[model samples]
Target chain A: MKKRTLISVPVIAALVAGVLFAQDITTWIKKTAGDKPALAVPDFRGAGDAQPLMAVFNATLYQDLSNSGLFEMKPKSTYPLNNPQQQGDIRPQDGKGLALADWASPPVNATHLVFGFATITNGVFAVYGNVDDTRQQTVQAAQLLSNRYLGSPVEADAIRKAHEFANDIIVKFGGSASLLDSHIYFTSSRGGAGGFGTEIWVMDWDGNNQKQLTHLGAQLAHLAISPDGSRLAFTSWPLAGGQPQIGMVNAETGRKIPFYNQQASLNSAATFTPDGMKLFYSSSASGTPQIYTSALDGQGFTRITSTRGNPTEPKVNPKNPNALLFVDGNPKEQIYRMNSEGSGMERVTNGEGEASNPAWHPDGQHFAYAWTRGYQAGEFNVFVADIAEPQKYEQLTHDGRNENPVWAPDGRYLAYMHTPLKSRNAQIYTMRADGKEIKPLTTQGINRYPVWGVK
Target chain B: MTSEFFRNRNLTLTATLLVAALFSGACGKKAPIPPPPAAPTATNTTPSSTNNTGTPGRPTATLTVAPARIERGGSVTLTWMTTNANDVSIDKGIGTVGSSGSQTLRPTDTITYTLTANGTNGSATATATVTIISPPPPVTPAVTRPNPMGTLESRLASDLKDAFFDYDSVNIRDDAHTVLVGNAAALRQIFMDFPNATVNVEGHCDERGSAEYNLGLGDRRASAARDVLVQLGVPEAKMKTISYGKERPQCTEATEACYQQNRRAHVSAGQ
Candidate 1:
């Protein structure tokens, strides 16, 4: 809401007064784990032909970094003495602006400096990105060789590539790595039958380049993408009035197959194990939905959680394979961990509304889930909690009814289903793990069950 | 909202897939409900179906299925409606259903599912078919694909009765025994007719409970029915059990009757 960026002109007198202003505006230590790292994103300077994209790259890179919610970027107004292009002496690999730390450290208040040069040669458009870690005094922070374009529309998205550099910088400072070109797999009712039922959709982290993966033309009960991002397992009544069963659709091909069809039973939440060799699915073949692990080929079936309530949504920890998390107990709080063998059960999150839809951040120690106050109908908000200490948690979204917060691979961002207080239509929304910079991916028609992964 | 349309406009060519689907029979099996050309676009015709038709407080019933003739063990959408009815029940173990809704039914044999809707105007009855048409002869090394010209000499999921159970318990009820007796007869007929045929018994529960544990509870219900069916002379080797827990509910309503209907054991063709 803070108008994405700040840009204002100064008169001669204003400039004279500003010229005398000098303070350590950059290298501020990050006080909290969720604190946004102070960063400076200068224009991705380019030669003559590429000058057309200077503004585009600048605004795009600035917005992308700003949208990441990991940086407190210094505006262009404060960037006069810190030009990376002025001397060409600051190599992108040497993480330098004006080829000197003193130029970017204090007055700009940037703990990290993200500067780059954009160039277009013959038919290729490219950006040379650099980062300056002033504290480490590391000359070569990190460089993204190429995230360029070849043909028409053909202008380089230098800033788009720079997002990777910014994310790398964020990760280096102990933050989640997102905005570096990750994809979000969500449900959308875009071009389905009569534009009717919701279909699984894929899009870039910024909600761009969205495409339909499966024209299910049916309501999706639960969705999980294979670890490799090649297949999608969904629950829905493909036949009118038919029972919900597990169905698989090729992620790239969108070819749907009734994967594990247990006739007349509900095969709701089906997920693939991290190794992609086994699929953890909740089958009601035994009257109650118990967690079952099966080979990807649907053989060698074994039961994991055979306890009290129906254990649905068995998510194997992304970091630790032996540790698993699912919504269990009679009341259904998430954060319940068990060995991959489904023993040594421990309840992590309790008395925090109805916790459901737990997804582990790449770090097995931390996870994000949805908490509803009373019943399943109550307004739900997303929260991130540690497995070691479930009580220690951070509530994420509050603007709407948010549920099923799933973590992206980088762990800095999550995608969830959000239905505003006034509307019945639920849209897919992705936000930073800390819950800032909430962005809705689909603008129309009942999108739900979003899972973020990569191919 | 094809993400590819934004990534590369060329991939938008898949948009014509729906057109190709219309001319091809295989696509029909893929997409059961292909919308008409003038289907609603701006605002979806609300999914919540209401019966404003028939006698205002009386009971009216409408039962229909798309593609009534399906391959053996294939699926069919059985949509049924009832208006101003205090009670709506369906035979074939669907039990108490919503006043108006649709279900995807995989009937192996040709069967007519009976619905009874009762209101102040007394009761109304309707029936829908889950028919299994002849499929193509089985080819060696069965390919995992929907066979457009597939034919079969047998049907399995629909012919048998679904055994109903109680809440939070997998114990079969006295009334359910009657249904189980009939289900045993059906299973016996299938076994006698086709020696290789095996039954996949599915356990289901109402939505009132947690989505996780209900799976085991559902399995208990299905296994309970399997035990009774086996005792009634159906071979135990022919039965395979699984649970859906509370994930799939026949009647999604938060009511006693709906829960009663959801808590049951369903018998169908097995994998």
Candidate 2:
């Protein structure tokens, strides 16, 4: 009887502990799954294809997932995937008919999957996609989208919708739904405002909310955002006689204040320090665009770099507060890293391609910059390189003239301005950090000089 | 032994029941206690007064005037008045008007206009406008501008163009001194041929310095050149200097050729 009583007590305690552990596990699972997953969709379709309509649907879906920032997106492969005659057609109709057993393995491990279809009916293009829950073996959601074809059959609008669809899929799956709502501030010269006059403009990350920040008459360039995203530092030359002055304007208040006023021609590519207490700029005030530093209050001016050649575009490393990365000009235009006081200059890349506009990742371990093979017209593209091992540089964009790569705060993606060789206008494009999943973040106007907001 | 066992079991049961009851009671009564009421307070009993005079509830009899805006050479009249006027006197812009209740005054150039009105309830002050028209333009000094040196003066021009100064320094070096000596000799001959002509020395710098510093450096370079000419027997007042700094560059490229052309001093003549 004594033995039985002792054993009964132990059994009761074990039962209570088991119940508590089960509850804890349930809570952990709920907490882990509470936030939406991030999705990355780099590129939807190329410029021209036989199935242009379907290409648009794929592009839109990819952009939608990317903008949603939920679900890790696989890099898009441009193989023969959509043709009906192909062995594996992943369009919605066929995707809906797929059996659970068919997708239980390798590439289809994703519990939720999206399939897109495009068709030109009576010369009017329409695209649609379906998201399926493979575990449930059911079509979770379907969207039918239409795109306008205004004479030109380039199908930019169709591709844009496909990007939107991917974002909608993540939203429907209970992900953080505000991913597509963010805006990108960039420089644009659309509307025949000729003579290298680029105005600051903002647009939705997925290319919808287009608005100009500066007046059409102002000559704006070299835009930088404060680490807090409360103010913007840029170079603006007034229409009247004066040098290009460094101007700081409240991002929300639109109150402009001059950061540096000098009579010499000042073309300042200004950037805020990580602590937001100082700014680094390249100015001819010292007789060339050598790097200079000043307090945020615009005092305590100091010449940080005295290199023989022009040193412009100073990008402070986000991870290491004491280090700075900048473009050392002439002959090579290669990216260099140095201390904040401009000592211990080290060359980071030795590629034949001239690299400029070095933008540091939030971690500062890696950076994205623009590279061109000399003065070739259509050879510019964005590349990423690890600072620790400077020799390892990876190309990010393969399209025409992509330059000025700025990283998103999360270090997962980059926003860059690209000017296609065929089109005179420049637009903003975004891609994953691994040089995959490229997509246009802006469609209207000539957008350039993109600076991602601090996270 | 049986009695002791019964007693121990009864005590253990009672203690367990007591703890369970306490926990239940605490959990069931989890609501916060209500706060105590605040005490009532008294209100003010004073009556309010009204008037345009200096009564407690009335606004003061102060006159206000907008600030005046006038062009550099233009003039404007300012006027002010008070309803209960005893004695009016203009405090500022006195020559234009002295009476305060109501007055019109005009002045050339910018002037501050103030007026005071004395009343039974004390004197009230009002400000008036004083407009001054355009000020005199900056005086254009009588400086000599030299004619463009011909091809015969190529060696002098080349020597002058190659003379680069140290950062921010304008003191003529031995090389620059020798070059300027030759140039001054050539300039003297040119001035003799054109007796009524005056020479203007323009100074410039390379593109590597700050704008203001460059401007000052250019000025110093021109001053150095002017002193050389004066020492060479040209009249001290005949040689005028202007510094263009890095602006108005002869070449806009970043190459050595362009930079060499940028750092120089030139002589221009005016007939």
Instruction: Single out the weakest 10-residue window by summed lDDT for candidate 2 chain A.
Output: A1-10
- i-RMS, each model, one decimal: 5.3, 10.5
The digit string of per-residue lDDT tens for model 1 on A333-440 reads 445666677766656677555677788877665677777645353356787765555665677776537877887776666788887656656788888666777888
Predicted candidate 1: interface RMSD?
A: 5.3
TM-score of each: 0.58, 0.46
Docking category of candidate 2:
incorrect
Q: List the candidate 1 regions with Cα displacement exceeding 4 Å.
A: A1-37, A86-107, A133-153, A156-159, A164-179, A192-196, A262-264, A329-335, A373-377, B1-271
Say which candidate scores most in lDDT: 1
Angstrom error of the Cα, residue A49, model 2: value is: 37
Question: What TM-score would chain B receive for each of the candidates shown?
Answer: 0.42, 0.39
